[model samples]
Target: MPVRHPAPTPPFNIIRMSHIELGVTNLDASRKFYTEILGLIETEQVGNSIYLRGLEERNHHSFVLTKVERPHVIRLGFKVASEADLDSMATYFGTKGMATGWVTQHGQGRSLQMRDPFGMPLEFCYEFAQAERMLQQYGAYRGCHPQRIDHFNCFTPNVQASHDFWALELGFRTTEYTVSEDADPQLWAIWMHRKGNIHDMAFTNGAGPRLHHVALWVPTAMHIIHLCDLMSTTGYLDNMERGPGRHGISNAFFLYVRDPDGHRIEIYTSDYLTVDPDLEPIEWQLRDPQRQTLWGAPAPKSWFEEGSLLAGANVQPPVLQAQPIIAS
Candidate 1:
């Protein structure tokens, strides 16, 4: 099916998306897929977890796929401005009634952990350490050397509520959305940014608060095509969920796949940057295929059906339910 993508918007004040983390059953397998096949350089390995950075990025690591026995998100870490910003975020989350914890020795930097209203673990930190060794190898058999962890798509039962929380509390601005005029929108997907770019994180209405997919940006569209060809040769053609197409909003080329545990991962390239504060968020129709895939193949049922659960320690604050937001 041909999917219709939204018209590309002029670049605004968005900064680049920073990092994403995922919990996996087997660290070795996940590492093989991301490093060996995906071309990301493994910068650090701590216990059962592995930290990978795009070959192009000098900043520590961009993707952290951890080997956890349980199927849930350990946390999604974002880079902040300073230690003071981290402290301020901790206080802000606490006042909002969310439990916040601190991480002092992670590869990228010191981080604070918390949860969204529906229970998806979130972390904010500053000061990622640069990796001393950079990987020199690159090829088609080797995964496309992604440049950085781009954006994250999260699922929530109440899209508007989640959107409001991130926007009003966390300082994320919306870039684009899919909505309806009549009944409550079944799916309200919004592109939100922290530092800038199209978005750092996005929220979609679904089952509960869960991690949907982690995206990695490549240097070019050909790299994405090479990735698709490599996947076909590796007998993992079925893993390609959608795309090798353009996005109407960011004007980037994109391709999505599923990991062994059903976690969604995307390979993308050429999205424009946002650099202004006066930029308005773009809106799209719920039925618009362009909103998801420019060439269009409907997102798989599994894409709509699955998400990462929250970690035990990061449950959301109870007061979130009483906030003046409607549930989907």
Candidate 2:
């Protein structure tokens, strides 16, 4: 089926996936992983929270780590086109019977926070504090360089409903998807994007409303390989969860690693462009092993069975469970 597009005009103009806020148990340990090892540039620190951005990002912060009792996601952030768009965002969600409110926080202005119909926490802000870009600052890179914040992949009980909310309600366009080929075929996953590359966020069939991983774009595949070598010798090899391999879905080079608090981050590169509105979304059958990894390696069980919790989300069970091919 061709992907459905929302009306040409939406209530607000969402620019792109902007940032993420995560609560971690150990601030010092998280800092060592993100800043010292992974090479995200620290922009600011306030109380128990630390603000960081990718090397090429000019936004004062694109990732926020805060000290909390548990490791959980606070919210995923989006950048709207303007302050007026921010207001429109609040109005649109509020009218939809979704929870919306203004949030006061550091490093950004006029932030609006909301929970989607599926209870995935989200925030939108128009103005952000700008910082010097570090794209050319080779010496500043501690190890593998994450150029910018990319897409987020998450687990939702109902991939179809989650896909509709983003594709038919908001204006995100699907670029790729996975479907079960059962007698009654069902969508098992959807990758939708607004930023003109591949995806800004993706939803996979699994437990309800949990973060699978947040991705950061690097310059090339070599960057990912470099990270693997760094971890292998740095006593963090155990933290490496999955690939330095290409994904059959996005066609991006990927590496998954766990932070000290076990929050997952994917170091990624090289997804194809999806700028043309007429681009047909690619489809893959659920049981096909290539859909998980293009080079034919089966995913580890943890990749499907585990995801980080969002604080107090109304979690639900998947309507239909998957029987994916996993490593033996």
Candidate 3:
């Protein structure tokens, strides 16, 4: 048996998930879906790119969409603690033989862009322009009224390898995880965080380098219900893919929807905090069907098999075979 070592202190600091860029086929349709349906406030429009922010956000943007030939994920952005951390990260990743470089395209300063060992495109920055926060503007609330970007869930070929890279090397703490039922347990999925909540990111063993979903936090459980109502009334019932259900892993209330371009977005709330260094992560057995949905509803096959392709990832082969789960 391999000895379990403690997660290492990261050499560089990542503050939180700052933004995400998605490549969309129809700029106008996707913008309307996000702004009119999802309630994200448009912060700026430049050329073929549109920047958006949640109601509680003060940043110029937390989500960006670019006109592209197909729908895909461009990058996952994280804010580093300082400009110095950017320099440190560049050196750290470069020393480890990962591709690293500076990007000046996203209204950021001296940003470091790199592909992690798993080939996920990540951007790190210390500065971005701020915007007016619309948290108190009740009249401006249109749809689900998302507060902020909660977390990103992605698919990887090897959950254990990706989990170690984030939890060990990137200084993220595991809040919850699922393990296989083998006599010797194996990692099946993991939820890790840097911002003291349930997770800033999570990985499940699946197809390589695909985005499972980008989650946005709504203010309350009622907000989730309101969004479902809005979607149904607004003729977007086809977009509602799954749930107004609770998850056993994060204890979050969730509703999954698909954008016009087929990218998945999750409206979520009610996850517990996880900031203490000594806090032990909650683990779930793979055979426990409630680990995914506490309400006894099972996720559809499309939810498991469909995900957005990443723009620059070198796809890898899947390592784990899918298994049957219990459903009520």
User: TM-scores for all candidates?
Assistant: 0.83, 0.97, 0.96
Query: Which pairs of residues clash in candidate 2, taking residues 3 or more apart in a chain or in different chains?
Result: none
Give the lowest summed-lDDT range of ten residues in model 1.
318-327
| Local accuracy of candidate 2 as per-residue lDDT tens digits, 232-311 | 99889999999999999889999999999888999999999998877888889998888989999988989988989987
lDDT of each: 0.69, 0.88, 0.86
Residue-wise C-alpha lDDT for candidate 1, range 67-110, written one tens digit per residue? 77876667777776677777877776677678889877577577
lDDT of 2: 0.88
Instruction: Show where candidate 1 strays beyond 4 Å.
Output: 1-17, 132-141, 181-187, 313-328
Clash count, candidate 3: 0
Order the candidate numbers by TM-score, best to worst. Answer: 2, 3, 1
lDDT of 3 by residue, 204-261 (tens): 7788789999999998899999999999999899999989899988999999999999
On lDDT, the stronger of 2 and 3 is: 2
